[model samples]
Target: MTLQTVILAAGMGSRLGRSLPKPLTELSDGRTIMRQQHDNIFAAFGDDAKITTVVGYRAETIVEAFPAADYVYNERYDQTNTSKSLLRALAATGKAGVLWMNGDVVFDPRILGRAIALIERDQSFVTVNTAKVSDEEVKYTVDAAGHIDELSKTVSNGIGEAVGINYVSARDKKAFMRQLARVGDQDYFERGLELAIREDGLRLAPMDISDLYAVEVDFAEDLERANLYV
Candidate 1:
């Protein structure tokens, strides 16, 4: 299957307060956070995956980090969130359904490979990267069947964390983009998708993953933990 990756790198890194995009932040291994993720995805998927990074805030930094990759710039990144960045990139994807990922994360490439394999198995599905949540984790409530039942960080009512990776078909990707273009005003990726699924009744197939220690870099504590593990 021909796969493309959309790495969402549009955050301003408010908690880091470094006056730089989160993706450009340095990692322990001397590689920038964005460079590590780009290399991870590229190394894992190889020629099969054409990677596109959705950039904003310090978009130039992201571009400099991975000039070989395709990109979509989101000027409204400050007012919006992940979904908007996704929408911009998805639109630029034109007719291909690809994997969606977060830029400010540290994880094993095998986790991404698992999700890609699942997508290749079934075209009309969504494979979400999941991890066993700890005290420092953002938990997602997964049903016995492995579908995400709910998600929470402060309430501790979830079973796993969303690793910010998914495999979707071109049809669903187009539909999602269309819906986002219509009413993605809230700018939350989850909210836009929930609206589409609830109102439009789009069914998303779920794949359960167990091969990664994925950490999303949101705050200082998350950065510390991610640096240590991923």
Candidate 2:
């Protein structure tokens, strides 16, 4: 089966204080954040990788940067959040499972390598960093069976932070999309995951990548830290 990847790049990223889209911000190694993501996806999946970027908040800039990627525009990007952007991409793709990440994440390429087995098994999962669980970041809790039970920034007693990388299996895609549509406009995509788990019995797994570097560049300090591994 071909590998499908989606990059959620619709946010304005106001905290980073960047004029350009956050994904276009330059990393220490000279590659833009999205460029590194593109390269990493290709490096892991080779020619089988099919990338679709959900664009808004200056969509033209991202389109111009990677004309090769399939594009899905979020018309309400300014009013909505990652939930809507992710819904758009999931709706646009075919029946295959999709691997997606926040566009601003700067991650080690090997992280994708670690997820290959789960992807191959058609498992739905979220990559997590147990080393740090900031209150502001999305966090997760597991069920009795060790599957993801709760997911959101507000989750209490969260085991770790969701690193913004995730996969929706073909089996669970329809249910997840439905939940995404049901969530509030301003909610993050994790809200949809939470609803899916509660309403549809979606068994989302948490894949730990704490040993590898995966930073979501939300602020200038985050960019500085992400650059350390670049």
Candidate 3:
């Protein structure tokens, strides 16, 4: 199966306070967040990568950012969530499986490689990269095998950190879009994916990830600290 990787970058990023989308915001090295993310993806897959970026908010900013990568706009990004954004990109491509990610995350290639390698080996399996979260960091719950147990937004107590990346197996484009549309009233993509796993009986695998992992940038402080790596 061919893999189409879509960067979910539809949010306005009110927390970053930038006039630009958070992915368009400049990293410390002077490279834009969007560029950094794309570069990492490109380095991983090179010519074999079928990359498409899902843009919203300042969609033009993303258009300007990855002039080479294909784009699909999610105009309802403000009201909806990443699941909807992902659905838009998936619909644009008539493919079977997709590799998905958050544009605002700071990740190393090893983490990305772990996820991609799983997809290449197992056609029907989903890969999750989870870290052991610190007391002060964002939290998630993980099953014994490291599949995502829960991405509780109100997760004040947990030991796992979701790496914000996955490879999805789509039965059909329409079915995936219908699943997304069904979850329009929900929070983020995790909720929708969970609902899919629960209702549609989807089971995912875990990437060989350890405690230290990528950080998704949401606030200025996160952007500031990520500066060192960017």
Candidate 4:
């Protein structure tokens, strides 16, 4: 099956204290987040990569930086959150089996390859890192069978933090979108995934990446750590 990768890039990145959109921020190696992501995805999927990005908050700059990507604009991005931005991008494509990623995350290509491998094994799951999870990180809980039971920042004493990357299986796409529409504008996409998992039996799992390095660039310090990982 063809997989469409929709990156949610509409956030303002106020926490990072940067004027540039989070996705446009450059790493120490001089390559921007968008370029790194594009290159990684391209390397993972090659010519079959169908990448689409949702742009807002300096949308033109992201477009100019990654012109080859199919673009979807979220005009209400200032009021809405990543959940709305993600749904808008997915709605535009109308395709099943989507690969989702947060715009601010930087990781090795092996992470994407591993995610795709899990999807091919008929599992829809999010990548998790067990290295260290801060209080601000989004965490999840997995049952004895490895199925995710809950996902939230308040998920204390659970598994590691979420990597903000996931696969939505074709079987769950319809119900997933429906539940996502019910989420408030000021919510992350994980909220909808939780709903899909609990209400519609979406079979969402957690794939651990404790040995791998992946950084969600929420602060200047996180960016520095990500640079070292590269």
Output the number of the lDDT-best candidate: 2
Which residues of candidate 1, in runs, are more than 4 Å off? 122-157
**Model 4: residues >4 Å from true position, as ranges?**
none
- The model with the greater TM-score, 2 or 3, is 2
List pairs with backbone clashes in candidate 2. none
TM-score of each: 0.83, 0.98, 0.84, 0.96
Task: Say which prediction, candidate 1 or candidate 2, comes out ahead on TM-score.
Answer: 2
- Clash pairs, candidate 4, are none
Better of 1 and 3 by TM-score: 3
Please give the range of 10 consecutive residues that has the lowest summed lDDT in model 4. Answer: 114-123
Per-residue lDDT, model 2, residue 221, is 95
TM-score order of candidates, top first: 2, 4, 3, 1
All models, RMSD in angstroms: 3.1, 0.8, 3.0, 1.3
Q: Give Cα-based local distance difference scores for all models.
A: 0.68, 0.94, 0.69, 0.86
> Where does candidate 1 clash, by residue pair?
140-159, 140-160
Cα lDDT of candidate 1 equals 0.68
lDDT of 1 by residue, 24-86 (tens): 878777887777777777677676668888887878876776788898888888788777888
Error of 1 at 18 (Å): 1.4
Q: What is the C-alpha RMSD, rounded to one decimal, of candidate 4? A: 1.3
Task: State, as a TM-score between 0 and 1, how close model 2 is to the true structure.
Answer: 0.98
